[model samples]
Target: MAQESKPWYRSQTKVGVVLLAGSAILATVGGWLTGSISMANAVVALIAEVGALKLAFGIRDWPVINRNK
Candidate 1:
């Protein structure tokens, strides 16, 4: 039996998680610095961090999306 090559994205997952965590921490701190961290602020931070990850790594497969169709 032969093993398949890992997808390119797997290599980037670690970096992505690190960046996501860093951004989340920064957001929390920024909110705390000004005042209390509201639920909406936390939600926005979560969404923005995920969006950043998607923009950075998810779009790498732009070609695959069209190719499979």
Candidate 2:
């Protein structure tokens, strides 16, 4: 029997990478285009980055659903 491959969204590492990249772009754009960085914005960005990292590194084995085997 052939094994199935997991979807990209199911991979925590992939999700984390995308989240981190998005947060970085937001921070850079917010800082560069506005010429000002707010503490609130920085805090939010930090939270997102850290959360993504935590989710990626801290979790193993994705949750599965079953219908009576």
Q: Output the number of the lDDT-best candidate.
A: 1
TM-score of model 2 vs. true structure: 0.43
**Regions of candidate 1 where Cα sits further than 4 Å from its true position:** 1-17, 20-35, 59-69
Q: lDDT score, residue 50, model 2? A: 61
lDDT of 2 by residue, 11-64 (tens): 777876877767786775678568687767777766777677556644442433
Ten-residue region with minimum lDDT total, candidate 2: 60-69
Q: What CA RMSD would candidate 2 show?
A: 8.8
Cα lDDT of model 1 by residue, 1-69, tens digit: 953445544766757665676778687768866778886777787677767656655564446664742
Every model's TM-score? 0.42, 0.43
Please identify model 2 stretches exceeding 4 Å from their true place.
1-4, 36-69
